[model samples]
Target: MATNRLLRTAGTVLTATALLLSGCSSGDSSPGAAASGQPTNGRTGSADTMPEAATATIKPLPTAVPAALRPYYGQKLTWRECGIVGFECTTMKAPLDYAKPSTATDLKLAVSRKKATGPGSRIGSLMVNPGGPGGSAIDYLQQYAPQPDAVRARYDMVAMDPRGVARSEPVTCLSSAQMDGYTRVDQTPDSDAEVDRLTSALRDFTRGCRARTGARLGHVSTAESARDMDVLRAVLGDDKLTYVGASYGTFLGATYAGLFPSRVGRLVLDGATDPSLPARTMNRDQTAGFNTAFTAFAKDCAKQRDCPLGTGSPEEAGRRLTALFKQLDARPAPTGSDRTLTESLATSGVTAAMYDEGAWPVLREYLAKAQKGDGSGLLALSDSYYERDPDGTYANQMFANPAVNCLDLPGAFSGPDEVRAALPAFRKASPVFGESFAWAALNCAYWPVKPTGEPHRITAEGAAPILVVGTTRDPATPYPWARALASQLSSATLLTYEGDGHTAYGRGSDCIDTTINTYLLEGTPPPPDKHCT
Candidate 1:
């Protein structure tokens, strides 16, 4: 029920996808190479130019450490067995405010790793982040333990929960009951009264964050988290950083490359986000991306015998779904509990399935049930999307999501007026999802803290060859964003996955897996024109 524009990873979505569909991986590794997969034509720059560009443009920091940061950069980390069978957990300290490194306040960040099971010599650490800006890298490591065998054979698999994420001192704000009410609030307002209610909700949400999070609210920007990562790299004893970042993590990785280009080893940015676009534009584009994904689902649903969307064309299917949403807006369907599936929650449930094609069947079943007045299935999907537990407690993600998003860039709109002004364009982008998303973008406008960062191109000119992987039908981070990020990074090689999903690396594409695996192992990037299905 947070802003729909958060470039979240497919961790929960993948889990739901796995339950409904077969052939899904456990988020750990991918199936082997697909012999039949082939590449399409189109080239950017020569892959051969990457090494030279990285070397020639490299601008490293001075050998002498800054006096203020030495303590953090030099501190030792104590790793101990925790979480699961194979993972080791540790904590590292970072200045609460990088600009005021001498301040007494500090943050203790959580980190986890699984040692390399090498038949070959160890090749340093390969850190991983699964987007969310709020996603717990430590949790991601635990869930996706034991990376691909080839990569695991060489590098130590590591993950550090960013400054204010799970395990770290997370940015907590809302209580479970408050969050339940927040999620059910109408996202698509009609009358001016409804608009006022939506604006008041955002204001209240911001007030809660300011009251609960305090001074740290202003310090949780993506740029600061990138700095934390560098200190982490230094303490881990890695001369250069090798990483795999997905969705919003790509932005984090790219920021690191831009800030410390000389220290980039081999970074794979999957489901890349474009740092050059303003917040509003990014939200608008994501609206269209979900529409593209939903269209695909509609087409697939039409082929089914009991398709709830009916045996109509994809366009017709969308119309039927849209009608259902409007009906829910007027009369929310009951979910057997005190809670009901309102238009906003119903829309969230449908959009959640757009993250991967595997959830299409589940969507069909839920849509059927919702039409028959049994909204429980759709409510469950909404719960999954929001990471809400049956006990009614919520994860810190929804809270941290807005905290980082609001501070990373200026809000998409300053007031409800701006959102109303942009509604036409949003609706044009996604006939079904656009208006709701347009209103969702207003959540950040009432932030108590002003943004510290802005839209700008990040050309990590001196970084080693970085891989930017994009899924053509990625619902969260659109395909064009990947292309845009790849183009922005001087040493990047774009790897295209002509598939349907939020990311490419471990989503069952042999061509994508093989190309990325080869790069992680041999330090060779896929050709700039590389495309796979």
Candidate 2:
């Protein structure tokens, strides 16, 4: 998951309250109110008053199964020509709406597997999810994940694109050109007119998605995606679902464990997000986490000889960077090409570089260029964050991002007035990030579909022990979220990676890699509170 600006300045209680209140309008009810089926004080419509349904019950295993079930369930999938060597691709069908299971809406899920290459006994499929809620797991598998020998040796490595994401039924909202317009919309609204413009952009974005893809939009909730995973598990014939999830994928994995506790096996959640937090709180914590990561970057940049910012101290470096952002905000910088980099793009570029230490040097170089009035490097970083291609085409991240995130949790703020009231608090939490991110929270405010779930604990009481990995200086999923989630789960072991970057496993920490690999291969959970430097 990329660092979202909306969550960076969510620490103010008054702002959160105002945002909540603004959600309740006499003429219009926000999706959060409607989907929650909670009462809105000002709204008279019954749409917001629907009774909460009983939690979906998982059925007992059937004694007799059909012949078709045999091949998928407990059958070893043979690897064949899947474009990539040693990898095979297969499709599994899941109900589009879990609530209407008997209905005939089959969502196709793309699955990939690389057979175990070890002399030891082969474990079942070990699934992986890179956090995006919108991130392509198959891309992650083919690119970064499968190279890990220790993991591939013992288990058949697998990755599936969740429904409405890539390789699955992709949910697209804007065309490439429209997306460019949307991305360029000023995120930092300084005046009432600017706030209205921001809101209009958000509403227009949501409306565009609804217009482009209406039927599939409402069905992309996390709960529905979790059910799809269970279907994948059954088709793969794994008695238990062994998996690894990072960032937002942790929430997906944890939800799966919660929904089907009896079927969980050797699950590992890295850079975990706490499922028990409200959107506002989660946003605030993430804001602080990014600031923490920025401080770390500043410290390192100060030591570099080519550092664009002054080398006196990290704080001084941060001040210089902040001043640079403000300068860009006032007068955007020109790239060699026709494109110019705005403050939002510059901030996004900086945020993208914060994801991995490997990118820090590149970021410093870009900062130096930007300081010299060249914006190409920073623009390139922002383009990567947006997943924009050379042809100006985009992956479905921006569109599918809100489709999944809004459904997973309610919005943080509801209106411009609320945002204005919360500005002071947001500014205090993240002076560098507050305005842009606090406005980013508005993305969900105009979502066409309402959220289907709320923040909740996922104990999965009877499930096997699950390993939760947290990076000490992770910019996306804060370490404390990992701690909070581990504490919430009944059978969870917290593994701490005292390091930088978004996730821990396979990122160079021998302690983290070895521990997670052993557990995946041998079914032994890492020791509780195990710290890896």
Candidate 3:
């Protein structure tokens, strides 16, 4: 995937959550001004900036479980064949409120596992997550989890759908028809009246979520999910949690290490996010990252024979693409079906292309068709990003995304005015991408639940060395965030991939894959500043 698209969506959606979930404290120092020459410090900052440093007191985990109260701790889990050949499916329960176990509601988590197939002893469960605060981890495991004999030999690959996510008490918001309308709502509102209309639509969207899924929405924070992960770890009989997380999953893994430091065994955090900065800074940094990715795309596109945006220069290609976006904003294209492709859909299509370079050729083809007024290709691309099925039903991402993000950090901009004020900077950072992204930041302004946590550092003071991976041109989780996170964690090792795209492992870099694999297998963390060309 192209790096720009990966980071742009992260900027847009993450910022939206930040705005909607305002008022939470961010465990970070004020960002340095451009003149300060002090890079935005997240990990290695002063005590004031590190909440983990100052708050040494651990509030006893909600409620204590005396031996009599702990029913499931050592209960033999009943597992059954779950249809797909070698896969086993099972449900695990967790308290809705950790502190009040008596008042706790049972949350059923869906889990799937493929047993180890090898000569080496099964070390433990290797849990995997595929980004979406809502993305289905089960689906990722089924479809994308590497099936190499080497990997399957020593690990029992496992995945779980977090609470309020797919297959595990999904948080339903809009129905198929309503979601269609919501997705079509003009994102780049031109006039003041249009902006008001857009905001009203956003409010309606959030209200729909509240009206439909109120009970489960508030409890889907990252902290709660991390807690759920611990329950999984205990149930799986793994002494330590071995996990591989991507995109937002990186944050999930980091949060896990923060909550249960001693339990961290082997962790691979790809496409890392700096959990130390507030949502606004993260959004800004992501916006800048997308711009960097876009520049790279433009350079490559300009040199291609089939380049639809012209071949004069990268700057010229960017201008052409920007003009196309503007044109789409003014008039959406028809998809032959009842569904029309709006500028928002068009933008999502472009953003989807940033995930992998393998998708670039596909993007070029779709852009060509889109320029000629045929939007089927672009629509398909957007559908994939939204995980929209042909039956018109949407995945839980639209629901779980807001639920998790809004709960993770405070909002970025308060209203359209704030977004407007930040527009010039966003546009300067990414001329082809600024406006739509600025508008996407508006989603959180309407979230139902207020944020519960702030941008805080996770330094399991006594934790083992954590490997933090970054792609130099990663659009979603910028390289700097990786650097900042590594610096912040007392025992973090920064592994750098001097290349493009989002996550590094399993994407073709022998250096990155081997280094991380060795760490996972041998508990040998890569040396700090380990650069892979």
Candidate 4:
């Protein structure tokens, strides 16, 4: 799933941590926080239009531990209480440039562990990541670890803020104040002037990141993060990494497996992403996925007494929402605070709900309020998606998200000219989100770091079985991606949850929970192509 668009689900363990949580928030009012979950969406054209992303001519990069890097692998963690009740925290270091071992640049990684409280035999540490390319794994484990009792009883739950993420030396682009205006800036510009303004804002954002953390920004690529994970794995005393990565985390996990196939142990990638898909395809599929999810929400809302977007059909609901957006575009609604609910914020708020059906009720309430000229509900939703605290502070989720995504892959669109060219296909893919998402996809084009990664298949041939889970109507991580990833990995078992929302792990599915726990604890992959309702 495109988690950088962000919030999984809150107040619900099952979907909350397993999906997108846009900009990371330290608190709950916190409903969804810092809301551009993913600047993804496109036209509803044939899949064939989504050309395969180009791969580098070079073979897959090797991640073998070099003699010079041995010090990092053998480093010891002197963990001490870092105030997360029952969890011990510490920091570890890795050379910032794995490619240049002798380079002085280095990175400090924030790591946390909740040691197993067991009656069962201990398996190794189950390293966890909540996605985002930027989602704080430490925050994820602390706030959203909904592991089975059996799994938690035996394995130490672990996570680290990948370099340039929370608690680490983050790649900062904007201050909270600057970010405040950035999130509200119109994404779907109607005039040439507006497009220039949006482009200028993005350019400023790119500059701020470079000004603040230029040296480190280029180093936080997923490959580098994967290498960093190896360092974490070694330091944690694990012979192999046993991980549960959701959404974007799947990319990181897959990268690790590709880099260190023999070191993969008990990996579960929920809401899988297809590494082979080009940025354009991923954006379009995700855009369509959100549209699909919105349709589902509309159908369910039509049965409610006060459906904000008419009760006729899902199509009508989309029409109503589109009209409301146009209305907001002309006259932003009052949010009860100084801030008004602009189209960008409102759109992001709606997408925040698309992550998990658990947020549907919240979306309905927000829409009703927005329609009533009280934009507070929608504003709160957007704030949650963006992780904008009432105190005006934001977590670094947004900053790190672009940092990693930009470095991991090339820009989705070359420039506004290209974006204009792709709009028709994007609109066909998702009339509701296409225009705005097409523009959002351009956010990476202004990045300071040139992408070092490429779209390539990962066979992880010698790795142990990898479990890939996908929900039928998951808005963020579409079902096809799970199928694609499962196929990509040499040894992978695909698990299907005939469901809605982002992920299926603990969303009250005993079958899913049991199957996953069995695999994790018993080291037995589920029978091939398992389905759970």
Highest-lDDT candidate: 4
- Per residue, candidate 4 scores C-alpha lDDT tens digits across 1-533 of 11245553323334433333221111000001111011122122232256654332112345566688888998888999765798999999888776566536777899999999998888889998888767788877877677867888899999898889889888788888888889888988888999899889888988999999878887776777777888898988899999998888887888788778888899999888877766777777877888899889999999988789888989899889999999999999998788999988889878877777777887888799899899988777777777777799988887887777776666676678877888888898788888887788777777777765556666787889999999999877789989988988889999999988887787788999999999999889888999999
Q: What's the lDDT for candidate 2?
A: 0.69
Candidate 3: 10-residue stretch with minimal lDDT? 14-23
- RMSD, each candidate, Å? 9.3, 7.4, 6.7, 6.2
**Model 1 per-residue lDDT tens digits across residues 371-412:** 999898888888877778789898787777778877766566
* Winning model by TM-score: 4
lDDT of each: 0.75, 0.69, 0.69, 0.76
Shift in Å, residue 142, candidate 1? 0.9
Q: List the residue pairs that clash in candidate 1.
A: none
TM-score against native, each model: 0.90, 0.86, 0.88, 0.92
Summing lDDT over every window of 10 consecutive residues in candidate 4, give the lowest-scoring window. Answer: 24-33
| Clashes per model (N, Cα, C within 3 A) | 0, 4, 13, 32
TM-score of 1: 0.90
Residue lDDT tens for model 2, 1-533: 12232111111100000011112110111124333222233211111121231222222222343344343334343445685888889877665654444335667778888889897778778888876767778877876662367667778888888888888989888889887777777778677787787788788878988988777888777666766677777777688899888777787788788767788898988888876655655565566677788888888888889888878776687789889888888888999887788887898878777777777888888999999899888888888777777789988766667777776555666667656666666666666666666667667778888765554556777889999988898877789988978987889999999988777777777888889878887789877799998
Off by over 4 Å in 2: 1-80, 102-104
Which is superior by TM-score, 1 or 4?
A: 4
